[model samples]
Target chain A: MKNLKIDETKYTPEMTFDPETLVIAIKGKSYPENTEEFYKPAFEWLEKNLSDLGKKGLTVNLELIYFNSSSSKALMNFFDMLEESVDNGDNITVNWMYEEDNESILEYGEEFLEDIETLPFNLVPLKSRE
Target chain B: MTDCIFELKNDLNKNGIFFCFSGPISQDLIVEIGDTLKNKMRLEDASKSSMRLVFSIIIEQAQNIIYYSEEKVRPWSAGVNAGSISVGIITVAKKDNSYIITSGNMIKTEHVDKLKEKIEKIKGMGKDELKQYYKSQRKKDPDEDSKGAGLGLIDIARKVSKPLEYNFSSIDETVSFFTVTTVVAEGL
Candidate 1:
């Protein structure tokens, strides 16, 4: 399957889904007016890609800058989807990346890991280039 | 009860309120208000950086009202919309020689539980811990959307000199008019 790329805006974030390696990256500030409307297409694409099994390993990277509470529930649903997919035999690795010194992002990673039993999550620290 | 709309000059002169607006809000409204607040705060010699922080919080909280407020009035346009959001008087008043900023808003009951949960958690955290948690939340997939968890309160807490304070009145079981008052310390 072909890769899907969604661009980010001042109020939203970018979404990337690839069939080549089964990896996805979402990065940006997401306080979208309509959370479901914005995420519907991406979720569909992910479902399709996961079903095809075109890639052996699945990795999801979240390097988000910001999001609203509505987006928080959506993130949980996304992880739930991943958890189920892994239970279905997909090898999923989720990496939550945070900039060094930004501890809020780290705790969020820990919180997301609380419910998942199927995926391997790595909370990686980002070294400041400054 | 306020007639709600007083002439800007008279209102300012009478109340000493630096800025105030009450009614419909959206992204457009937020941008417009942000521009004005940013300017006024800077002119008052409030640090530009901290002022930006306050402006962002105002936008988020106001947007919440625009989207979630149940209070409705007959609309000549834009259909039935959310309740009003007002940015009341913000003074650079001194407390023991330090400056503090105070802003307020009214929210709904359903929204109140959620806000309280989040706010309480934020209050429980240490500054460094809150910073890390916020960073970690940001690092998560943005596609995993939340109704209020994202940048709204986190940004407010990060920018504020201390934790936020809130009060509310139960209009009924289904609704509440919640108010959030946040302060910023300007070292004397």
Candidate 2:
């Protein structure tokens, strides 16, 4: 399958799903005009590549600055899909990256981890780039 | 006309309203007004988290109007999926070191009871409960007509420093005017 790379837009995030190194990164703000439509390609790519995952282990990085309620739901669905991979014996790790000073984002990361069973989830804080 | 315009400006200033929009609301307008809100908040020295909270609230409320407002206009477009714009009013104000977000729109009268029940539940929920509810709701499939995950109210509740406030007034036998407000305290 082809790697997925969607450049960031004003109201969406940059999504990079590479099957080669097994590093999936979704970064930037997310409040797309159509949440379901914006996330369609990512979902399709993951569904196609699920079988190829876990051999080398998969790392998912989420570095979102702001996301609307709709995008939040999309993230939950995406994580659910990854958790399913874990159930299939895939070695998957999810790193939720947030700025150090923003406690709200940190709390958000914790919230997303609530339903993630059996996946290696870590909340990683980065220093604010001033 | 000039005096009317001046009076309107004066009223907004008197109420500490920094931003206000009342008309057809679309995705493009949300992006445009959101940028203006951020620039204004930055100039006011809003903290990082506070800015995020304000922006999130604004977007959620605006989208609530966009998705649920009863008053709508179909706009001719070249895209495959035809679009409609909702009509509503959104205002951001400052009072007692707290920022307030207020949104108003019309809703079908039949939906008022259900909306009230949902709002009351959100109003009664503490932060932890709201967070749990938001997560659970996020997991559910969005309704067929829903443009969002149906977690907007809970998400707004989570950010607010107080219980969410709402008002509904009968506009006609078939529709009602609805308004919701959330406040973010100055400190966090």
Candidate 3:
């Protein structure tokens, strides 16, 4: 499968789905007017790649500063898909990154993990680069 | 100059309002005003999380206008990416020790009752209950491809320090003006 890369815009996040690397990274803000339209491709890619990547394991990195409620719902669906992959015996790890000292963002990550049973989800605090 | 205009400014000043906008709201405008608001909050020494909370509410309110407001316009006549626009009023003001964000727009008269019920339910929930509701609502499928989680107001209700305030004023037989105001305590 080919990789998909979408650059970040003011109202949407950057998305990188790599079949070769077995990694999917979504970063930045997300509040698109059409949440389904924005996230459709990622879901499609995951559906196609989950089987192949299941053998080698996959890593998903999420580094979101802010997302609208619509985006939040889309994210929950995406994680559910990932959980399904794990249920099918895929080795998946989700790394949720948030700014240091921001417990609210961290809390969101925790909330997302509450329902998943098998995926190894980690909340990684992002330190300032400066 | 117009005396009434001066009086309006005075009225805003009397209420401790520092920023206000009315008319068309687009994604670009939200980013511009949101950046300025974040900078102002930083200058005021608001905590990082508080700034983020205020900014998130701003985006949700702006998106509510863009997606659901009855007053909409097409900014571009033709393009693969042409977009529709929505008009609304948004204001940020200070009341006592809290920061208040208010958004006003027009909605179909038929939607007023449902909106009222939703807001009333959110207003009655405490923080933990709000969190539980938000989680369950987040898991539900979107009613349509165009619809969202339909939880913006509930999410806003979660961040607020007190009960949310809202009003509906009839403008015609078909539509009404809807306004929602949420407040975040200064130190939260």
Candidate 4:
């Protein structure tokens, strides 16, 4: 399958999925008005591609500066999907990146980490942006 | 009317309100408000975390208005296909070393009791309780009538430095005006 790329908007995150390397990166702020609509395409793509995963496994990186509550729910749903895939014996790991000084983001990452089971979810903190 | 503008400005300033917007609210407007507030707070040397909390509260409150406000109007001049926009008021203020966010919207009278009960329960929750509640609610599907995840209020409750404050005023037999306030300490 071809790679999926969505450029970031003022209120949406940049999302890119690479099939060859098995790395999916979602970065930036996400507070789209229609959270479900905004994430529908990515969900569809993952549904179609996750079942055909190779031994290399899939790496998902989520680096969000800020996201509203609805977007938070969407992220939860996204992670739930990944957890389901992991349960089905598909190799999947998630990296949740946040800035060191932004405790709110870190706390959010930690909450998600707590909810997730069986998925390798890591909270990677980047140094404060200059 | 023109002369009252100065009095209005003074009133807002006296109340510590630095930013205020009333009327139609849309997604694009939320982006602009969030960015502008971030920039304004940054200039004041507010910490990154505090700014994030303030911004998140505003987003949640404004979104609630966008989703459930009973007052709406289509910008007829924009075109027939133009979508209707929710009407509400949002304001950000600085007082006692805390940032105060207030949002007001019109809601159907039938929703008042349910909304009040929800906020009341959330207001009674402690920090740890709020966190647990948020996590549990996040896992569930939104209520049938909810347009967004039903977790917005709980999320707001978790970030706030104090319990959420809310009020409802009957506008008529069919509708009421609802307002909610969230406060975040600047240094926290």
- Once fitted onto the true fold, the runs of candidate 4 whose alpha carbons sit more than 4 angstroms away are none
Give candidate 4's whole-model lDDT. 0.92
Candidate number with greatest DockQ: 4
Candidate 3, which CAPRI tier? high
lDDT of 3: 0.86
The interface root-mean-square deviations, each candidate in sequence, come to 5.6, 1.1, 1.2, 0.8
The best candidate by lDDT is 4
Which lDDT tens digits does candidate 2 get at residues A1-130? 6889999988899999988888999999899867988999888888888757765699999999889988888988888888888888888899999989878778888888777877789999999865
lDDT of 1 by residue, B1-188 (tens): 24544565575556444566566555566666666776766676865445545655666666666555665444455445643333232332334323344444445567677768888998888877876776567556443325444656775676677678777778887776766766656531
* Chain B TM-score in each of the candidates: 0.71, 0.92, 0.91, 0.97
lDDT of 3 at A40: 90
- Ten-residue region with minimum lDDT total, candidate 2 chain B: B75-84
User: What TM-score, computed on C-alpha atoms, does each candidate reach?
Assistant: 0.62, 0.94, 0.94, 0.97
What are the DockQ scores of the candidates, in order? 0.15, 0.82, 0.82, 0.84
Indicate the fraction of true inter-chain contacts that candidate 2 also forms: 0.85
Please give, for residues A1-130, the per-residue lDDT of candidate 3 as tens digits. Answer: 7999999998899999887888989999888878988999888887887778876988989999888898889888888888888888889899999988777779889988896677789999999542
For each model, chain A TM-score? 0.90, 0.95, 0.94, 0.96
Model number with the top TM-score? 4
Per-residue alpha-carbon lDDT of model 2 for B28-143, expressed as tens digits? 89988889988988898888778888888999999899889999877765365777789999999999989999999999999899889989988888777887788878888876
Q: Higher TM-score: candidate 3 or 4?
A: 4
Give one digit per residue, the lDDT tens place, for model 1 in A95-118.
888877555566667877765666
